[model samples]
Target: MNFLSPLTEGLRGLGRAVLFLFTILAGIPAALLRPRLILQQIYSVGVLSLIIIVISGSFIGMVLALQGYRTLVNFGAASSLGVLVALSIVRELGPVVTALLFAGRAGSALAAEIGLMKATDQLSGMEMMAVDPIKRVIAPRFIAGLVAMPLLVSIFSLMAIGVAGGHAIGVELLGVDDGSYWSQINQAMHGTDIRDMLIKGTVFGLAISWIAVYQGYHAAPTSEGVSRATTSTVVVSSLAVLALDFVLTAFMFH
Candidate 1:
């Protein structure tokens, strides 16, 4: 019975998260009218997350180049560095990694901020004023997360292509023929590849934002509760992104 308690709580949490998502979606029409709020949340969630995204994307791209150069060496196909980098980043790495990072940074912050508001009675205060916090607050953050995620993913792909594929590995260090690298990528990649990635980013964003807000909104008004919610937001969001990636990849590729 004791062991089952955790499982029960987990199920309850999942149900709550799902219900919260429906509420957020239902409020979307009204939320759109408040563009200012959505934009502010976008800056908070997206713009603030850019520095980490850029730095992480750049370094990861360089590292991928370094490792990929070794792997392609075995086949004497070093010129395919661009193909390897582009395909890996565009198809999988870019969206997945960006979402994971966003979950850690922005998602945690969102959870904490919302949780703190709850603790301070601000959420309750809104109810007293006949205001729906779901529409005014949570919906905007949800929209911003969805919008920012794809943009962040796009930026990540660009960094990976330029820094990892073009500059670090293919051109500057490896001396691979630039013409072969670029031509292979142009020939290998198609519109579907780009479309699938956008789909992935959007899905990941939706999952992360929902988890973050759900945890915070339902959290107990205590320091420990808020802390737990914040941590849960990151862990759950990251796992959700990876799981979604696997499922999305299977369908997209199959």
Candidate 2:
């Protein structure tokens, strides 16, 4: 009976999460009608996340270019480095890394903010005023995350492209042929890669937002509980991002 209790609780929680998701989705149209709310959250979650994404993308791109250059040079295929780097960024690293970062930054922030709101009885105050907190608060944040993710992934990939990404190190520093670099990328990269990136970004955004908001919404109205929910948001959102990336990669690439 004791063992079954945990399983039952997990199942019950899953059910609640699904229901909560539906409620948010139902409110999204209304939230969209109030684009200002969504825009505010976009600034909160998306714009604020750019510094980390840019810095991380730069480092990742530089490292990948350096390592790939060494290995490809051994094979006398150094010219293909640009194609390798671009494909890697567009297909895998861009969306996945951005999502992990988003989970850590925006996702945890969303959970903590909402949890604090709940703890402070702000949500209850809305109810007392006959307002739907779900419509006013959660849905806008969810929509903002959903809209901002693909944009963030695009920015991150751009960072990996020329600014501080592979091009800076692969071409200028490593003496790779400039024409071969861009031309190879033009030839090898395809529309499917872009499609895959956008799809993964959108899906990951939805999943991360759902987990963050749900955890916060249900958090016990206490300081410790809000803190736990915030921690859980980061942990669960990260695991979910990795798992979903694997699934998405297998489905899209394989």
Candidate 3:
């Protein structure tokens, strides 16, 4: 009975999470009609997240180039480096790394913002004023996250593929033929490849953002509670991104 308690609780939590997600999605249509609010949220979620994405993407691409180059050199197929780097950055690293960073940066921020609101009784205050916090507050942030994620992922992939993969390592360090580098990338990468990556980004964005808002909205109205919710937001969002990436990869590729 004790062991079953934990399992039952887990199932209950999962159910609540699903219901919470639907509630947020339900509010999104109202948010879409308010472009001004959505734009502000986009700036908050998307623009604010750019610096971390760019820096992380650059370093990750460089590291992949360095490691990939060593491996390919042994095979005497170093020119294939471009395709390798492209596939990695475009298909995997770009979306996964961007989502993780977004979880830490934007996801954490969303949770903290909402959690703080709860802790301060702002949500209750809205209720007293005949306002629904879900529509006014959470919906715009949710919409913004959905809008921002794809753009952020695309920029991250481009910066990684262009500067780190193409220029820095491929051109400067390894002396890979610039023409061949780009040519192989063009040959190996197809529309489906890009489509798959974007799909992952979209799904990840929805999941991470949804988790953040739910955690915040349901957090206990205490300082410690808010802090705990914020931490959980980051941890859960990161794990969700990784897990989703695996499932998405399996379905998309294999």
TM-score of each: 0.95, 0.98, 0.97
* CA-lDDT, candidates in order: 0.91, 0.94, 0.89
By TM-score, is 1 or 3 better?
Answer: 3
Please say which candidate is ahead in lDDT: 1 or 2.
Answer: 2
Q: Decide which is better by TM-score, 1 or 2.
A: 2
lDDT of 2 by residue, 1-254 (tens): 79899999989989999999999999998898999999999999999999999999898889989999999999999999999999999999999999999999999999999999999999999999999999999999999999999999998998887688899999999999989989999999999889899999999999999999999999999999999999999998989999999999899867
Pairs in steric clash, model 1: none
- Model 2 poorest ten-residue lDDT run: 158-167
Q: Which model, 2 or 3, shows the larger lDDT?
A: 2
TM-score of candidate 3 against the unseen true structure: 0.97
State the local distance difference test value for candidate 1: 0.91
Residue 20 deviation, candidate 1, in Å? 1.2
Q: Which one is best on lDDT?
A: 2
Q: Write the per-residue lDDT of candidate 1 for residues 88-152, one digit (tens) a residue.
A: 99999999999999999999999999999999999999989999999988999999999999999
